[model samples]
Target: MKVVEQIKAPILDEMETFEQKFSNSMSSKVALLNRITHYIVNRKGKQMRPMFVFLVAKMLSDNEKANERTFRGASVIELIHTATLVHDDVVDDSNMRRGFFSVNALWKNKIAVLVGDYLLSKGLLLSIDNEDFDLLKIISVAVREMSEGELLQIEKARKLDISEAVYYDIIRQKTATLIAACCSLGAASVQPNSVHVEKMRKFGELIGMAFQIKDDLFDYGETAIGKPTGIDIKEQKMTLPLIYALNTATDKDKDWMINSVKNHNKNKLRVKQVIQKVKDLGGLEYAEKKMLTFKMEAIDILQQYPNSDYKSALELMVNYVIDRKK
Candidate 1:
């Protein structure tokens, strides 16, 4: 079945409400924070974080109470995500995000940092108001892991010596950890049991890993989206596919590829050369196959649960996560 057909409309409707709730919380700030918040709102994102929260909650409990609680929780998750993006742009010195002028780019690094801090404070305050200690703990842990992951990636970036295992570990920590937390928090909202929570968390982790690897793959793979391919190679970060390709490359090819990444200037011409080299080395193809494996692993986990619209939707989301055009 087509993945979109498998995602029930009811879940999407609920997610819309979650988006509104999350956006409303960012309101009432001063001009700069308000503008940055609105700028973020204007740019489109899949709202995937909240979707995961709502989907997991629906699987365990489909009642009105559960839905409401999960929506609130999901909004919190999205807010945290937004806060991170604001900070990430500043750190990356990025000029754009989601195809819009980034806060840092539009305003300045100092203002962007302040805006990020405000968003984080708001998220924390909301979490506290909800009085869910577990939720607070999850956010705290996720932030810690995210910071560590970013630092680790920065430290290891551009080094061709990076292995596939280390590549997976970095993505898992930086991208997957928070996604896993969303599912875990959603399940906990209803069941609050370890088994179900852990199951959903694991499912999210695997899917999140695939989701990001696929994103990285697009930097080399065929992309319909306007995302410039091989940006990471230009940035010198050795992602999973590159790591795998390097491991399997011919000795001369490996040496040349390594030199290409390390020695190339940030100019467009050199970046294109490295991209062509990656394509020749089959890095993009290897990443696609690996992404498919993780997507299937996520689907396999849903097999443990009974057949339901929620389970089906979760399965559909797994496919959507990797196959998304943008």
Candidate 2:
């Protein structure tokens, strides 16, 4: 079975209910807002964030009952995630997302900005209305971390000076924090002990770290995964592979690599050369090893829980994190 299919199988009924609740959360009185939101709902991605929320909640809950708080938790996290994506498209100046025109592309920057804000408010209000303050705290921290990560990356990108440690920090905040929040929210939704919530957060963080590393590795390959190869290089984003290659390269080769990224990034041949050099220098191997380390660590955490379909699905999701092509 597909990764999503495997992960959602155990939670199929709850997922349907979650979908309805999610749509209701996105509704608005304003016609234009409603139309845009309807479009967003129609063109939604895999809903992986909410799935994580539900799966972890089920896995950890003593009674295994997906209560109203659980549904609200999923809805809140999904709203926050959607808001981030809408805002990200504007920030990236991208015209498309998930194979469709981005909100910014269709509605212009101002409207897109407002729509993102609206979604964010909806998420906050959901938590407040449902008194899901624990979930609110978790997601709010993720939001703050995400903003910091983006700004830090932008600052480093201008000078091309991201170290390996900084690279990890950036990815943790930019990508992993929200995923961690999803898992933590899942545990919290079930009213688990603080220990369980913390453990799930750590597991999610490890998987998320592996996931980002896998995505960074893709930049050096020729695989067609929506974006073109060397796009990260062309954009001057210092991923793990390139960072590793640069650290181990000879001074002359290092200067060449740095200069190419700084000046010749727009040149297709130069980008390909950088990609090739990264591979030749064992960058991909290093990244793969690190990715697997995190993946294993995440799996080890799951071993503490009793065996169940939900636990098995969570394990599948960890494997899927490193295995996904895109």
Candidate 3:
């Protein structure tokens, strides 16, 4: 079986049930909205977020049985996450996502924006109506962090001089925060007043940190792990490898790298050269080391949990975050 399938084995029933709940959460009275949501549901990715929710919930629940709140939490997360992606496609003017045409590409930006808003409201109402205040707090904070992270990256993009510290801050808010919410929500759904919520949140944050670093590494690698190699340079996104390369480079080389990113970003040759420079500077090696560090820390967090299918699946997920090709 595929690794994702393997990781999902223990939670197969919950995943299937969650899918129905997720579909119901997206329902609307308007036909157009229904059509669009149907499309979105059909084109869904790996559903890793909900998997995290169920795995953590089941692991921590009294009888290894995830309750109704767990399903609702997972649905709320996926709903809000989809809302963000729709808005992101509009903002980035992206034509495709996961090999399918983006919502903006199909319905135009105005409709896409409205759809995003609708999804956002649906997610929020799901929590508010259910009085899942603690869960809402967790997801709300993540959304705020995501918006801040995106804006921060835009501001830093202008400078092209992001420090390693700033770089970590960006990814933590941008990518890690949502996954952290997932794990925390997982624990919260099962045990409202337990410290495991915080523990799982930190665990998920480590996995998310490693996950984003792995994504950054793909930009300099020969393999296409969700995007083209050197695309980060072409788009002038300051990833960890490039940041490390710039920090350690001589004044002349550093100046050249910045110039290439700022001005020659569109030129294929210059982008390739920049990728090679980053590689030669041990940028990739340094990033891989950091990625492993997060992975180990996440694994260590699980050391306190006893042996079980849920814990085992969670471990597989941590490794899969760094090991998956795309």
Best by lDDT: 3
Which prediction has more favorable lDDT, 1 or 3?
A: 3
**RMSD after Cα superposition, model 1:** 2.7
For residues 17-120, could you state the per-residue lDDT of candidate 3 as single tens digits? 99888999999999999999999999999999999999999988766567999999999999999999999999999999999999999999999999999999
The stretch of ten residues in a row with the least summed lDDT in candidate 1 is: 1-10
Q: What C-alpha lDDT, on a 0 to 100 scale, does residue 223 get in candidate 3?
A: 55
What 10-residue stretch in candidate 3 is worst by lDDT? 220-229
Candidate 1 per-residue lDDT over residues 1-326, each given as its tens digit: 54554574548677667668878888863776777788788795666677788878888885853455576677677777788988999988999997788899989999889888888888888878877667767767888988888888888873556777877888888999999999988998787756888888888899989989878877764578644567787778877767876788789978877877787746677777767776777777888888899888888889988888888788878878887875
Candidate 2, 280: how far from true, in Å?
A: 1.1
Query: Tens digit of lDDT per residue, candidate 2, span 34-87?
Result: 999999988988888988999999987766569898899899988988999999
Instruction: Give the residue spans of candidate 1 off by over 4 A.
Output: 1-8, 29-32, 225-228, 265-273
- Per-candidate local distance difference test: 0.79, 0.91, 0.94
Specify the poorest-scoring 10-residue window by lDDT in model 2: 219-228
- Error (Å) of candidate 3 at residue 10 is 0.5
lDDT of 1 at 132: 69
The top-ranked prediction according to TM-score is 3
RMSD of 3: 1.4
What's the lDDT for residue 154 in model 1?
81
